[model samples]
Target: MADSITTIGFDADDTLWQNEQFFRSSERQFAAMLAPYFDGDDLMDRLLAVEKRNLQYYGFGIKGFTLSLVETAIEVTEGNIPASVIADILAAGREMLWHPVETLPHVTETLEGLADRYRLVLITKGDLFDQERKLAQSGLGDFFDAIEIVSDKDRSTYERIFTQHGDGPRHAVMVGNSLKSDVVPAIEAGSWGVFVPHELTWVLEHVDEPVSSSRFRRIETLRALPEVLAEISAAYSAA
Candidate 1:
């Protein structure tokens, strides 16, 4: 609600569209396929561990995720898995390539409402081709003034974006679903962060600490955004 704020950044993936559900469904299918070799819990644990370890080496995207699935499947089966099983896992990974391509509840309306007042930017990180495909299909693309598909979200990234836009952290706000990739870094960069939790946030995006800053708040749905933004604007004016 700071009066000086004229720019807002948005995270893609789970923020504006359905992303994690695809991964979750894929994981379920993977577990079902691997049940003959190991328990569901153990298999999931190994997959999670592999994903975490690979994030450092491969960053984020379908490539790394697919590789993790392949590696975990091979590891759990102890090299005894059939070629068909491997094919099934690879198919499951490819199935995650396309999502339903619909904006979250209120996301479109909120973006339209905010467009008149703020310079909106779509800032997301992931596989370039897949991310672009989703964005192109979203129909929400036109509302944004800029679209940045980055490799990661960190302080330097935020700084670079703001500088390029001729803005500063104090006058910027970041809205998204991931506490790790969106909210924490935005707050750390001295900007406001609004968290709209999705039903299936990735386990990797989970945060250990509570978000308790005055500059940070959480909303249950995207539909609540316009009113919340209005309140922020009003408060900024009052200050």
Candidate 2:
């Protein structure tokens, strides 16, 4: 029998639109500002370490990002940095507000094509209001059958969404940029996953291990997804 996929979950941030570009630009500014106190490598390492440790406390979003900046600044500066420096970092974080739209070269056409063959769901994690506003403005909202703006992407979150949507693990697929947030969880839940590399994926999203399963695949662009899905469907049919 052919493997049946009824629902496809998509990540919104870097997957659908230009998200990490802003973060990358802000990170460069942050490093420049901290140049007097620390070199770029040292400052970035410190910030990455701090963010890894604080993921539980801050979860994901602007709040965590702001805290990472504050914590890193205080630690590296030995509490001697001026209040203005911290204020600037906070301002930078606040400026990260994004307007949603497609980022890939041909994202709209790809989503339009996929929507015809699969049930689509927008699964993103972030500040509720900000995410909602982006979706509303993106003009791509109509493509999704459901929108899940979550605080975290974990096993529980995936399970809950699958259950709520009446989708079985075997019949669902997740497509996104982050391996840590999107791919692993989907695989753990017995769902297929598609990884689309972005220009500015966070260090936390990196995965060291090779993807060994036939169900998990990687593509370079959103435009290539329709063909990949067709291939997957063909393979399943053959089996």
Candidate 3:
């Protein structure tokens, strides 16, 4: 229950500010750029495959994605991708890196309300520089007790975060859009996992929905979170 929990970790990107939507838009643009030589859907699918394969080498971020886009274009076009097309791909990456960090509806306000009463930490996974840049520009950095931009989210990662915060798993909760990245691992690591679904999740992040567990919950939106926590805490206190 919420009352028993002392530390809360939030995933950045879609959970706090706009992220995947930009990537989705960029993918469409990339596909359109290559529409002459390759079918758009096929091109996008190839690009996704390249991204998946390159994830280990490039990790996650705009730079790697831009590189993958270029690589995909070259491969699809048999090394005939024009310089102009390459330039456009690079420009898209720049636009993404420079895009305004728009905090989602009620995200900052929710953090504000919760920060006053509980320890809040940001536990996001991405390129270090890009993640830090977004956090600096987000204007909500002051609300967090700690910030952890990890390479990935797994059970060990969540366990370490809990240990670092001195809360352990029983006293911590993780909230985010990706069930795979945020909820399941946190729950497996002995913490509460709250799934806040987003409309435009990447297909790669999808998994079967998690069944309800003692420390797992699914909520429609962050707007209902405060009340949810209150109810959980009340139940905890009763127990």
TM-score of 1: 0.93
Residue range 1-239, candidate 1, lDDT tens digits: 33578888999988898888788888889888888877546788889999999988887988789889989988887887778988998887777776558677778888998898888989999999899989989999999999899989998888888657637777888899998888888888878888988888888798943357878878888787776777777778878
- Candidate 3 has its poorest 10 consecutive residues by lDDT at 36-45
Per-residue C-alpha lDDT of model 2 across residues 67-98, encoded as one tens digit per residue: 89889998998887788888999888877764
- TM-score-superior candidate, 2 or 3: 3
Residue 103's lDDT within candidate 1 is 70
TM-score of each: 0.93, 0.89, 0.95
CA-lDDT, candidates in order:
0.84, 0.80, 0.88
| Comparison by lDDT, 2 against 3, better one | 3
For model 3, how does the per-residue alpha-carbon lDDT over 1-239 read when each residue is reduced to its tens digit?
A: 34487888999988888899999999889888888877645777788899999999998889999999999999999998899999999999999988989888888789989997878999998889899999999998999999998888999999999889746877888899999999999999988889999988888889877786877788887887888777667667887
The global Cα lDDT (0 to 1) of model 1 is 0.84
lDDT for predicted candidate 2 compared with the true structure: 0.80
114 Cα displacement, candidate 1 (Å): 1.2
